[model samples]
Target: MIDEQTARERVVSAADRLFYARGVQAVGMDAVRSESGVSLKRIYALFPSKEDLIVAVLRHRTDRWNAGVTDAVDGAGTPRERLLAVFDFLAGWFREDDFRGCAFINVFGELGGGSDRIAEAVREQKESFRRQVADLVRAAGGPGHLAPQLVLLAEGAQTAAAISRDPDMAGHARAAADTLIRCALDDAGEPAAAA
Candidate 1:
């Protein structure tokens, strides 16, 4: 028999795959139980309700994603490199066989604007991402307005990769982002491109 912690982890793991692959609304608790190989009673004991489990899953995924992006950006040599690194990360992620689309976006689609908690969580995650990018741009000495444009380009690249399965979108996104960063630098009366 799986321990309580193990059962909870299994439930979360199973739900993560299913929820991301399919949509949150499309996957039921029964499916999670079966996929996790845990009994329904144990699942209930760990998570009081499906919505509770959903929240947990979203939080877990958000944390993992944020960590990944932080790592990717931090490893780069310059702010412009860090900014473009985001697309590189997405390009690689979209190539995975299990990759579908953005989990947060899929969850939002599932909820259809109904759950305030889910909506808030999604908003917070996006806002964090935006802030992270903006801060990186500011630190790199980019103009104030470049952050928003870079964010849009990053998001657009993700959407394109998700729909078209083309890693080249990352290159295009990088080009656009680089152009914005250069413009920002130029506006700030500094070298327009990072070394």
Candidate 2:
């Protein structure tokens, strides 16, 4: 007698593990049913199709994941700290035993080109991440152009951290971010209003 919300959560949780462990294409609906213990009929009733379930899983991950990491970023004492906190958040995430890089990046690589919905979801997450950094960058007094560059650093850190299996890449990225911020603040060009 599981409620609809409970059943939905169970399905999404099962799908996340299965899909992350073995690409979305490899895990079948039946496996989700078995893992979640939600009858096939109920599963379908909750999510009409495998694609629907995949979309739902991505959405679920985005919501929960964003809330946690964004809180870390937002709770920083300063704008620059907020920017660096993003890498800190990533570092924490990379330490998890189940860490396998970002879910959006992983799923997009596996099914992005052919799946419009998947690509859209990944794009939305990426854009949301960039916007967060952009806000931090503006608040930190960095040049407007630095937002995208910072995003590249953040994403590169993720890939490097995953490949090297070393969370210390977060430190490297944070150092680079610090340097960028310093340079931006120290730039004493000829734009002096009172020559």
Compose the digit string of candidate 1's lDDT tens values, residues 26-69.
Answer: 89889998899998998988999888888888888888888988
User: In candidate 2, what are the lDDT values of residues 40-130, reduced to their tens digit?
Assistant: 9999998988888988899988888789768898788866677778878877888888877778898998889989988998898888878
Worst 10 residues of 1 by lDDT: 186-195
lDDT, residue 169, candidate 1: 81
lDDT of each: 0.81, 0.83
Local distance difference test, candidate 1? 0.81
TM-score, predicted candidate 1 vs. hidden true structure: 0.91
Error of 2 at 111 (Å): 0.5
Backbone clash tally (model 1): 0
Model 1 spans > 4 angstroms off? none
Give candidate 2's error at residue 163 in angstroms: 2.0
Clashes of each: 0, 0
